[model samples]
Target: MSQGKLSPRQKMINLMYLIFIAMLALNMSKEVLSAFGLLEKKITNANVATSERNVAFMESLSTMALEQPEQYAAVKRKADQVSEISATLDAYLGDIKRQMMTTLKAEDFEDFEVQDQPDFLDQR
Candidate 1:
């Protein structure tokens, strides 16, 4: 039967089919999945690096407390500020990563090669 003449049950089935097709399309698109994986990996690495740095900083703080009690409080205060800044930076990086992923089209990840000369100026 024509779509215009479809009953309620047929319409519902058609809607479901559309949704299923859309989901399949998304899953089959390598660019979309690659983008998702790239962003997820970056976030995981960032968390790992942050944890490692914080652990090292805490160790240094303990050593400082034993060797230089006077500067310990100052170091602790600066560490707190640094931690806050790191958190903000992480959030900003996450947002940028997500935006880039969403904005990238299928052609963007086709080659997936880094430039010969990486842009150091873009780091900041």
Candidate 2:
């Protein structure tokens, strides 16, 4: 709008505008990060519940196999194999998570309240 130069008041107004916009952006990012943290917590809880249910089901299957070996033994064996594979994959993923936390120097994996920074994984 101004062709030549801006007045002192105009400069202050422009500076305040920039600061206001930056504050809004910062607030929005925090809110989004908080939402993500909540979602992560919910997913973790669900996983734990599902794991517990799976264990109970496996136990039931084992009992059934004991009662009727010819009918349920094969099914139980297959379930055990699947369980073993799942354990292996879980351990592998856990190791990867530990490595990431070590690299990031993070004390707690669930802590997401820290300020946003550039992607450290990208630096690697």
Candidate 3:
């Protein structure tokens, strides 16, 4: 392993080593990207579940308010306010996502295979 000129066999071994290292790096990158995609999907699913639960809870509040207006009406009003705010925020965030997709020229962010430019977002 001297710094001096090496034999052809040694040079070939070094080139192979370099190639192997590059391959490992590429494989690791793909695995990391896959993990990120899976995480995003899990988070999206959880958000959907949470939204469903919130809707169910809101419905129950509506029922309670109708059944006992004296006690639950105020509570229902507050709940309705929260729901309205949530809807507004959700719409704002959705608009932001649409803008991002438009800027990226992406049909679907979940389709990682179609995303070729890793630095597209960075450039913006």
Top candidate, metric lDDT: 2
User: Candidate 2, which segments miss by more than 4 Å at Cα?
Assistant: 1-30, 105-109, 113-120
TM per candidate comes to 0.38, 0.63, 0.60
For every model shown, the clashing-pair count is 0, 0, 0
lDDT of 2 by residue, 84-119 (tens): 999999899878656666644456456665524435
Ordered list by lDDT, greatest first: 2, 3, 1
Clashes of 2: 0
Q: What is candidate 1's lDDT per residue for 1-124, written digit by digit as tens?
A: 4646878998899899999999987554546556766886798889899899888987889788778879797877787788889889979987875655444455653343321112433443
The regions of model 3 sitting more than 4 angstroms off are 1-34, 105-108, 111-124
Better of 1 and 2 by TM-score: 2
Query: Could you give candidate 3's per-residue lDDT for residues 38-68 as a string of tens digits?
Result: 8878998999999999999999999999999
Instruction: Name model 1 segments beyond 4 Å from true.
Output: 1-51, 59-69, 105-124
- The TM-score of predicted model 3 comes to 0.60
